[model samples]
Target: MFKVMTGKQAAELINDGDSVSINGFGSVSHPDEIDKAIEERFLDTGKPRDLTMIFASGQGHNKKGAYADRLGQEGLVKKVIGGHFALMPQIREMIARNKIQAYNLPQGVICHLFRACASNKPGILTKVGIHTFIDPRFGAGRLNEISKETWVELMELNGEEYLYYKTPRVNVAIVRGTTADPSGNITAEKESLIVDALHICQAAKANNGKVIVQVERLSTNPANPRQVIVPGVLVDAVVLAPDQKQTISEIYNPAYSGEIRMPHEQINRVIDEIREIDRRAGVAKERSYASMIIGRRAAQELRPGNVINLGVGLPEMVSIAAQERGTINDLIFTIEPGVIGGVPSVGGSFGASFNPDIIYSQASQFDFYDGGGLDIAYMGAMEVDQKGNVNVSRLGDKVIGVGGFVNITQSAKKVVYCFPFMGGGLDVKFDNGSLTIVREGRIEKFSKEVQQISFSGNYATKNQQPVLYVTERCVFSLTIGGLALIEIAPGIDLHRDILGKLPFQPIVSDQLKTMDMNCFTSP
Candidate 1:
């Protein structure tokens, strides 16, 4: 049987130098009250020090910052390991300053590592990070000097090469859920569906570690069998945190998705007001008006029966456009990590949400993604080479680590990469509703060779996958020779916008036409 305690009392179970694993994906399923309790404990007693934390999602507590951020601030954590830290800016900065040790791993690999521990396995072996930064021969997954450690090693089995991934024995496991029944069965239905709370608890138990679950409520009767995510056998302690907030989503509030169904006329009026201001400024630049132009263009792409997966950055704006166009109902939108038919949380909290229609654990979600279940996937690329191999993982000294980019891009049948024509310092303009290039960003996305090949052009070519590169100035499609320019933004010159910056010549199609005029028109 599991004992129930308040969040504060539950957190008291942890001790100094404990290797704790937290069950969360970005912000969803995070134990906020437990996190607060830990923070308060650190503030009052300052007992725990040199702790190592393993998390599945991006670091941070709530939207403000990551849990590691607070631990780093209090000098509590000695080292950290997990995938994605967009929500944990403070932790990233700490790594930059050499204040803490951090390792950014593939999201799926992290999930497997926990599962490996649960199964009493020594380590995990896979071909996922071959030829990438995670490969041991290539710097051994080092994000910073403090994080430089050889975690992955190349090994041969049955005359085939594989990467061996090792995970530390967990000392304690922290998880969050909707409720804990009297029998200790935990239901996390209202939170991320993708997480395997029972797996974490079982893994911790197998390692002789304690499992702490922070729940929103405690039920008297046995939870419905179908609703039980973690069985009673795996649970040790159930923490009743009534005041713990739910992860941000429609389950908490609809506004997080920014889907406000407004009248078409009202949307047009807003566009008109924006265009009038641009006209007064006497600049037809798209940079000054990209928000409106991109939003309008994305709205046009939203069609009924389209199962769309929106990428981060500018692609997120597509959801807003879809909502305004009254197509949000028609489309089933999903995020990378197994979240289906729901508005994805943005910024650092980039994982499954609490209000999704369906959720699968990160492992199962990746299985679907890697198996090519998605019809269309909109991704953001930092750079695209002539071969169409995308670079989204590493950029020079900075390593963001491929979270689910490889799986999604490789699996999606129709992959559309939305990016600016030029990065760094670029500008654009519109004349009589036609786009014009005014200034240019310094960075080149179309590079001679990408820093890392996260998405292999050879794979796409072999599979005959459809790939389209959508930019502010032009649209290109993958061809046998190279990227073939198919369309240009209205008023954009081929020589100035397309030919001038590329390190090599690109195939120009004679059938190329101007991008949609409505793309620049007021909504």
Candidate 2:
């Protein structure tokens, strides 16, 4: 029913003005060979112009001239509907310049939309984007002036309001897997993450569209039915790429695919290697004294036997601190890409877990997240306002977009935001449990109002969700009256260091106390 083809031949299957959905999370599971082939064909022949590119999670390495950037040519991509774009610089540049129509939706919502599309559902109705930027009352997820289409609308059912996200027609789906059988049965046993491949393939097939799969190798015999992720009936073409890497980071790691469990000592070495790589690439700040302090403070919120998710960036420090406290194994860790109960990898290998307990589809994992399965979710914040609303999506002219922030923060029983008090050029030092600010940064993250509302404080308060804002200098708890100062670092003057920096006054706790001395100093 399906034919085997070269990457270039498979690229030819994509017609001009087609809506293409790519199944991947970050750089993992990307059909790189086929995508590169498409780029080559477009540059040489100028065919397949004005395409609509869609993806749930942002793909590409966090650099220029890589991944999605290959297809970021002027006429190649006319529009982009994606979740996160910070890693895809060229595509982000096009969107920022208004050269393309762009809409930034929540990653989880996009993943679920694929599933809805497979069944020919009109749209998805959920409270995930309510009161956030994706809500119709706000910007409705438009990233630039050219994004004029109405894909999300506000609706009310049974006296409750929800944001209904319309499904888009997927004419082609670019998916990747480890191996393909003679019948085009795809198995992902060697891939790092399955992502939304199955749903994307089904969505395209349901619409009488093509499903192009990139696999590492082809098998002469039929594949076992139990191991086939996408049956042969759903596959239209199979492109063999024998040299495919597991992820953008490594060539192949058995631990990532759950083929083998990594030793605790070996896992530490891998983490160290990743941190060194991140440091060299400038993807993350060197584990500074301030970051350690913030991490230590945030890790205190973790309870034993709790299911938690530590978001990328500043929130990742929480895990390092938890590991230092010897409490990392006591709690379960989950990532947005559907990995559960294993140490989540960092840097370029983030979406893939090392020795995972279970790997579910991205949509299924979001179903758990949307249903309040997370006990606590620690995320990074760009700005915090008096209303207790946090903004991690957009800042000034940059459109970072909410990537699972709305879903996790809105549904988690407890939400903790880890951030620095100041931005740009902050300097700090600690001595004998006392913290001192050497130099303040030019940018103030705490303000009277934020530029965007990624997480609605009012919504969380309405649901009686407990919230905390953890910083290097102090901690604030979200009360009914807004942000309440609960803890202050020792040797930091309240008036000069804390109150003077804030644009508005906050209610000081009646029993305010000094932060634990251990948080400031290394064990």
Candidate 3:
């Protein structure tokens, strides 16, 4: 009668061709011990072969501890339908070789679809990925040629475009938390971030499937009744890990779970960790003048007390610039992985924080995003086409599914596309407020057309949203006429360095002005 069991026992319940959903985002809040147990079970017996595994975002912060990657590498997962594969490069290599059937759906859509599965609803009909890749006319969330089955279909309703993601009953839900009682009530008091744990368990039970939760400790006195996220009635299995980590990188931190507010020294620890990473990677403490310039220019868009969201990559520099300017704490900062009101850790620590004010379920955060609570969102872009369309998900063969990018960009009042003018070895320098393009990158980011329309400028314009494309050498704004070159960096030639290098000509603003001199100097 005891629901408490070893991870191996939980893995034994999974069978071949079963659909399993694991809870995690940016590698935090996943049941890594249980996942490793499943991997070990597959390697020993290979009984749970060809399973359909689902997750919302990148499983791990980096290459290590990627639960999905371990399952895929062990040949346990037949197909993967999730948001990202950038962190799991080992499995991405498998995807490249067509070893598994993989479909990469947008993070928000998949997270929302889990809610539909939990309620036994028919399916999800949302205006998320309408025109680009998720549309049936395109690929319908199929990642590669190996992914032929379409789970998303484009449907029109009331003259609006919607991608209906067909929901499959989750046969098994595997999730993690900090503690559990004898009856298996869960509480995430020590987790780095509380992702979609509540929904993951519900989706599994809605299908009459077993809900197995992994927890760090067993509370003898029982978790506080009010803190019970997953009640006892819904849980079928509990795997305990006494030494569970708050994240792959850290052992534990109470500040991460929002249990207690930490002091200033503790909050700066994550920042120090980032600096150590930069030192190990040989990146200078100060970034390039180009990035600093772009970051400063983008920071200009921020207003105090604004609830701002920032996406990964160059836009991440906005936070760094904010910190350098000592204005990061002035406005509230939130990221998709559910951390709110903190200096969001960049790179490998994508989802966790040192001194987060509060953590909530990622679903709720996206709900706030979809409801237009975000004042602004700064995003990193791979390319900006002549029509002002931004591409951040597609490249050579990588289909980095829109991980909260679409949801944030489409809904935020103002969106800023932050990145350098070019990529692949482009270098710039600034001396005495004079900017110089030391080396031109072999690749041009501003092309005639983007490979994908991850962020539709036309859609933003239709919604009466303002967009700023902030780059190192110049700044652009999306106008009715298209991308208007509004500002150029000091000491840079508009004709030779900007216009001559652009694959597509932009609208020349009649009032073009030189970029602010302070952008090239220290904060």
Candidate 4:
């Protein structure tokens, strides 16, 4: 039987220097009360030094009110392992200062690793990290001196090479849901997807670790047995957290997908305004209007009744463009880790945003994505190859592991890639409310080959899914032959702007048109 306790009471299960695996994704689906309890315990006892905190993705409430933020401020964590932590500046500083050990692992690999542990497997084996920095041959997942030994090791199975990702024993597992029945069965229907809470609980149980759950409400009877995601047998404690709120949905008011149905006249007006802005700013070329132009183009693809997910970087800007065009309310916007109908966080804080309407655990969100419930996904790419493969994990010297790009992009019906024509160094000039490119970027994001395969081209082509590559200078679509050029920017000669930069020639479309002119100036 599972006992119901307050957040503080249940958090006492953690001991000093214990390894804790927190179930979270960015700002969505985090255990609030339990996190607060952990912070309180550290402040009161001060015994836990070198505590290991493992998370599959970014964890932390913002400065205003997030559980991870409180814990980081209290100095309760000594080491952290997981994917991205862009949302938690305090924790990032701690890792940068060598005060904590931080390991960046692929988000999908971490989720699957937990599943492997639950199944009593040795470790996870995959080719996702072969040529990237996650491999031992490169920098691995090492972030600081404390993580020198945490590099991923390569192994072979029947002469086939693979990467071995090990999982450590968990002392505690903290999770959240919408409600729990008296039998300790939890459900998160309002969340974007069902997470992997059961797997975490079972893994913790296997290691004799405690499992704590935080929920918004407790039901009088057991929920429909079929809907019970985490059985009572795997749960040790339950905490009622009615006061805890969803982070991202509250910050940005997300419009549900089923509600998006904009009038064609409205869209045209917005496009015209954007064109005027670009023309006034002398941004007649598509490459020069990359950011705003791509935003407008993506907005055109959004349908009224489709569930959509947006990745960080340029994709984040699409929401603003959508909002400006009065189409914000017609589309449902969801973020990975079970946040639905919320504004996405910008820049480094890619995890959770300020306010969200619905919040669920990280595991549940993955279930939704894996189940193929999303209609479309807009993402950013560091490099894309002719085969239509995308790589956002490893660049020349950096190792920012795939956060949730693999899950969301691979599962969505349509994947739109947004990026600049080039990266590295670029100069821009904004004058008289007009924008101009003083100099072009130097780095090449499109290559004959990529550093790693985050989005598999073969898998995409096999499924016959629609993949669109949008850049400042041109737009391309993945075709059976290879990359096919679909559009070109104004004021750019096709050979000079397109063929010269690419490693190989892309099949060109005879119907290629100039980029819209309204992206450069203010409406």
Candidate 5:
């Protein structure tokens, strides 16, 4: 039998110097009530200090002082082993200031590590992080000076190199579900997305640790075994938060829970509602001409019946472009959170799909992705060098760790990197199917060398993967030598707009042609 406790009691169960694992994707499926209680306890009593916090993906409400960031007090988290830190500004600040030890790994690798911990495996041995920052030769996923431990090791397995990531022993798991019974049977029937809660629970139980689950309500009737995601045997305690939300933005949406298959038209309405919410929240919406041009060209790369993954930021416009071309149904869309064949929600509700065909654990989806299941992947790039190496994880001072970029890009048969030619206040105008640059951006995206390699060009080249670099101004293809300029937009001077802006010279294809005019005009 399992005990039912308040959020405060669950928070008290956590002790100092314990390794805690949290389950969530972006803002979805977070045990916010428990997280809040822990924060309150830490502030009031300063108990449960020096926790080693771990998460597979980002868990934030797209704003400060929400979600996992609530537990980011200086003394609360002594170390952080996370896959992504874009949303956790408070914790990231600690890492920047060298106040805490931080290790950044691939999101998929971390998800698989949780499974490895459940089975008492020594570590996860795979080639997912080869030649990237996660490799020992390339900084070994360390985010700060204090993160000196070698969690990742490069070993030779049967003449082939592999990255062995040691799994962390979890002492406590804070998970969330929709419903629970007195026996602690947990069901995620009402949650927006079931990320890695099951794996987290199993890992905790395997270590003889505590598993604290937050649910919307408690039920006397026994939960159906078919619907029980985490069995009672694995769960130790359940906390009831009657006012729990499905997502940060949504209270309850049957479409997100797969209870109802929303009509395609209604899916569009859901997207509109999210955009409206963003507008009201003062989020800066980027509806720019450069993104439109790049989105149209990126959408052209899609093939019928192809399984695709689109990264956040500029790559999100691909879905909108496909919608304009009436080909959204021809291709199957998948997100990193195991949501397949549905319209992916944006902004605060990113990880959840509006009407998904199926939802699996994040680990299962990565298994498919790591096995080369993705036909094509379009990802955003912060920097692209002449060697076609892309960097989306880090900039000068910020360490926006790679979430799923490395896993998808390295395993995909074909990869297309999408980003503007320049960043930071780039302005453009399209006049009657002709492109003109109104204002140049302060920063050039293409450079002599990228600061960090999130996706290795040499690995892609060695594997013979097709790669393309798409921008609003021109298109480049990966060649044996470097990037080759293959196409340029109309009404744009090649040397003045493209060549002059590039820091290093690129191979100009003799058969270079003009970009499709249809991309610039309205759909």
Candidate 6:
């Protein structure tokens, strides 16, 4: 049996020391009203203390309204297990200072672990985290010194090796949906994305835990069976939010819910708005000369009819370059939030796409990713060591957890990394068909050893998977001998601008080639 109640009443179920999992991706699909209500209760009574918070992907509107941050800020959480938390400044501060036990795991693995919990399995076993930071050989997903409890371990059944992610007892699940019937049947038809709502509910129920759902409306009539994402029998409580926005940052928008088709022409306006927002927020890219060059070179790798994923940062520029090259129609673009064949949005609406060809559930999208359906993936590089291992997940203490980077890069047939040779003020010039470096950044991107390995160069060599690291001045490819410098810009001196700048020497191919002149002279 289930009861319909107010958000405040529903939030009371979150007891002290509860292991809580909230179903959402970014700011979308969050149980905002209920989440705020929980924090309010904590502020008033401070009853729920020492909780374990878990999430597959990020959930927050921003710094001020982040639900997870409220938990950490109010001393409500004892430990945190999340897929991504870069957006949560307060929570990151807590983790950096070792205020709480924190762990960052793969988004796919955490989401799949819900399935494992639902099925009453011991844990999830996969090779996704092998050789990366999540591997037990590494810190075993620990993000801080206080993360002493090891929830991940190495396991082998038969001849194959696996990383078994031990399941945690999820005592409560916080989810959101559009409407619920008198019988508590829930429908997520109004959401921008249905991200593991079913699994989150089931995982809590499997543990005999409480289920709290936030919904926009309560239906006066019975809901159709087909409309129910989570049946009434599984849900414990329904929290009605009369004024719930579509997403925390966004109000009701038909384009997000696919209720109305967003005009192709209007998408640029939306993108511009998002870019302006990002600019004000200090996350906007200034379209550097190196980024433009790398984008142009990386776009050339995309072939007609290929399924490609363009990661954030420099790789996001690849789409613009593709459009400029008049090759936009030649390939498909995908983001991890299940928006396929549509132009992926950025910033607030990034998880949703404009005029999507198809929108599947997040689980289905990960199924595609895990099965190696992506042909090629373009990602950014914070650092790349001498061994070809790229570190985009973490740099120093900043925990930019592997949020779908692993599943996509590891599964893709070809992986392209767009980055720069140096880290500081890198000035470049294009004259005729040649490129010149006026100044260079002081930070060394190429190191003898990276702070962390997000992608294993050794794995690429073992699987014979092709990888290319494109920069403004040079291009390197994965070889049996390690990172092989295969191409260099025409005007740049190999020893001065390229080789001498690198902290470590790379294998120079005997038949080293010059980059195409079209890249420099292109309009």
How do all models score by TM-score?
0.81, 0.98, 0.95, 0.68, 0.98, 0.95
* Candidates sorted by lDDT, best first: 5, 2, 6, 3, 1, 4
Q: Positional deviation of 15 in candidate 6, in angstroms? A: 0.3
List ranges where model 5 is wrong by over 4 Å.
none
Give per-residue CA lDDT, model 1, range 197-267, as digits (tens).
66677778888888888888888888999978788877777887676544432234332222333444554
Better of 1 and 3 by TM-score: 3
Is candidate 2 or 3 superior in lDDT? Answer: 2
Residue-wise C-alpha lDDT for candidate 4, range 399-478, written one tens digit per residue: 45577777677678899998887776554544564334567789888899887777777667767979888876678988
lDDT, residue 154, model 6? 92
Better of 3 and 4 by TM-score: 3
What lDDT score is found at residue 4 in candidate 3?
88
lDDT of 4: 0.69
lDDT of each: 0.70, 0.89, 0.80, 0.69, 0.89, 0.82
- List model 6 lDDT by residue over 211-255, tens digit each: 998898888888888768888888999988878776544577677
C-alpha RMSD between model 5 and the true structure:
1.1
The C-alpha stretches of model 6 lying farther than 4 A from their native spots are 61-65, 247-249, 281-283, 521-523
Candidate 2 residue-wise lDDT, 117-214, digit = tens: 89999999999989988898988999888889988999999999999999988879999998899888999998878889999999998889999999
- Weakest ten-residue segment in model 4 by summed lDDT: 250-259
lDDT of 5: 0.89
Q: Tell how far residue 276 is off in model 2, in angstroms.
A: 2.1
